[model samples]
Target: MAAGAGALAPVPGVPSASLHEFPYPPQTRPRVSGGSPAGGVPPATDLVLGATAGCLACVLTNPLEVVKTRLQLQGELQPPGTYPRPYRGVLRALGAVCRADGLRGLQKGLAASLLYQGLMNGVRFYCYSHAEDAGWTRYPGGTVAAGAIAGAVGAFVGSPAYLVKTHLQAQTLSSVAVGHQHNHESISGAFESIYRQHGVAGLWRGVTGAVPRVAVGSAAQLATFASAKDWVCEHQWFREGSWAAVLAGGMVSGVAVAVTMTPFDVVSTRLYNQPVDADGTGKLYRGFLDCVLQISSKEGLLGLYKGIGAVYLRLGPHTVLSLFFWDELRKMVQHQQPPGP
Candidate 1:
């Protein structure tokens, strides 16, 4: 039977004409059809695994993010008082963080990152899958629309955690500076401090820029991924495996997101870290227009994309891992399902 099945399968070097059609033996079809139950793995399982992997990666790479943020936020555009650049690039930054604050420094905002990513990716994947299932996949712009909505919601839900994380990551420098003392040491500490000082509003300090950035970036990512996957599948570039589709899709998606959202990302980062007093008591960015004007006037047009390289660095691996792992997890779940509805 195995030998017969092999004979019917597509030749190893030949490209299949259609993706939906498989050149497999008739007997194998029954085995495959009988192995899995209806509905296969729950969408939530994919969410859980993707979210876990995403959060883990974020925690591991956060030191790079910290260095990137500091580099972008430098007031002088040069090292302060000849402190050996404070943090140069990824490796140098990691070394400095480890040297100064020990291993704990590398994990400065780990808790907040985990919490934020878990919520962000969890909702993102869940909503995206549901959108695909609900005939949204058939629409012309459905992928982008679904991704925009998912990202906007995720950004809002995860904003508070992000605020805490950014503040904690920034706190280390405050201690070293003269007459500048930071009290927050942990995620809870940062949250409490922000709430105590600025109430609920403080926790959402950067919502204006953040919302648009996430929406645009997410739309670009999903649209690019879907389009790329379709193209690759049509071209028979990597067999019929979902992992190959994901890899190709993720590369295009990462590049699209990074390029499209660069300006908004810079604005969002600054808005999040800016001193509230500088903009006024309650105004985070004095409206988006004013924020743009200020950044342009003070820092120049280049300032709008300050840390774009880091964005690529972080996003490349992030999107690749996310999409690839998501496909694999889905497959595993399908394989494990019982033989019933």
Candidate 2:
């Protein structure tokens, strides 16, 4: 998914081919709508649609997100075999959380998850849609560039929510807890505590890690999806506008996103969840570069890919569902609109 960005379940399909065979859709071109310079759904509508899709996907995929967060933080800065691996694998991790915190524990950060997904994807989709409508996506690499910009903007906007979500998800009983425990009692409490302790700046902490994480994820996700759609159609594996094509594209996008985003995801999670000093600076890492250097040196390169399986598992279905819902919702809204005079 998009640095947790977007995700899709695996679909049965063939690989994509040359862009020459499948030109960009004409409808994707810019247009004047309601006397405003925009394309497709209005920016506001796109925001709502994206948020709705993201929230829906988050609900379904949050359990995996929780597990993935714990897995990533389990043995921070420690050698692989040196740490106690309480959560051995995905299923085992889930089982461990369930046993320790019960069924509700699996949904530890539901509120924060919804808040983050809705805000992040809303801004991401809105910005990307705006860029597309402005003709920025018409260039050779415009789509990826636009996607990255949109995702970075979205990540910045939603960093506070992500910060809270990470803390909440990692808030299991100390016995099985990994990383620093913020021990936030509730979402509101977490916000209050951080703000009271660190002021407004504290809320935006770790944004440095989040922006790139989502930018890379969104870029790869959108680009691959576009290409995969063409590939599926070129091979006659699925009709151009059919559901099968969408699923195939989503599956390919999911794989590309997971591979590209995992390392950033790990860094972002650490930056967000690590304990902060009296001045609100990260105790473990002074900044993004320092975090990377320390992680690579202390834990080795594989440390960067701590929770790849959980990331992919969460990403695949989340991307597919979020995109499917987003498009369907847009179509529905567009249909209900009155024709232009």
Candidate 3:
């Protein structure tokens, strides 16, 4: 789970008392043949591992990501639950997209999605692992704040990729002309066009919104994953270090992430994709709070939770795969290292 800036308020229902326990055996920290300044394995190991896991998961669920983006951006100004809106819900939205543009429509932003995930999670996991190794995440209390800081750093770096991804996903001819379908045909082209049009600042269009979204998501995900896995191990729910424990912990994390992230995710998508005039003022949302207020008033509370199904589908398996892979990689690293002096 995400780990150590400020105290992360306890996740409701998880006992605070036992959250400090580490699930894995505590071996003495060892020196490395090639390592970071810390004398242990370089934190870049986590970066590479996270990117591997993120890119792999992105390929599998890009369709869901595309669909989820569309769902969030769809019907923004339209009345809640209204038909004649291009997309209404999961099944209807999926059918509408396929019928209009074919299955390729759902894959609209796959490239950007993969690139963004690699950039974002690479930094995210790298930062979190460092904090964990330093014992910042020795307890659950600091997990969320730690994740927020790491998430913000990663989001800032990857904002352009995410902006491109959202623009591609939000494209539909019917409604939401307020949101643009970019003319660029490739990822590089998209990046170039945005830079040429808006300069360096243009590429980071929604970073303000993205930072909180990712921070909350990372914290909710990693903290719960670590705690749940530890709890499962303590009770012998599954053999320690087994996939079963990993999967169980990941599942718990998915729910927390979904609940914490959807609102901020919506804000990030809108801020990123909303069309701006030559002067760069958003036509749809005045700002993040305005977007939430408008959505809440017009679409009701459920508006905040749009695309939740697609979120769960994408995030659940993603959390499972990434955590499982990261855990296994760490175990392998520990295994290969000689005993600490």
Candidate whose lDDT is highest: 2
| CA lDDT, every model vs. true structure | 0.58, 0.79, 0.68
lDDT value for candidate 1? 0.58
TM-score: model 2 vs. ground truth: 0.89
Question: Which residues of candidate 1, in runs, are more than 4 Å off?
Answer: 1-40, 43-47, 76-85, 89-96, 174-182, 226-253, 277-284
lDDT of 2 at 310: 85
Error of 1 at 193 (Å): 1.6
List the lowest-lDDT window of 10 residues for candidate 3: 1-10
lDDT by residue for model 2 (151-177), tens: 899999999999999999999887898
What TM-scores do the predictions have?
0.74, 0.89, 0.81
Superposed model 3: Cα runs more than 4 Å off = 1-40, 172-179, 226-245, 328-341
lDDT of 3 by residue, 94-135 (tens): 887787768898788788887888888788767866665576
What is the TM-score of candidate 3?
Answer: 0.81
Query: In candidate 1, what are the lDDT values of residues 1-341, reduced to their tens digit?
Result: 00000011122223344322331111112123543214543446646865765675575557666655655565422223433356565666667667777778777777887787777777666565555545464466655676678777767777787767666666665433211124476778788878888788878888786777778887766555545545677787765555566466455556667677777776776677766663235343576667777767766777676656667566655665554455456567667776653
Instruction: Decide which is better by TM-score, 2 or 3.
Output: 2
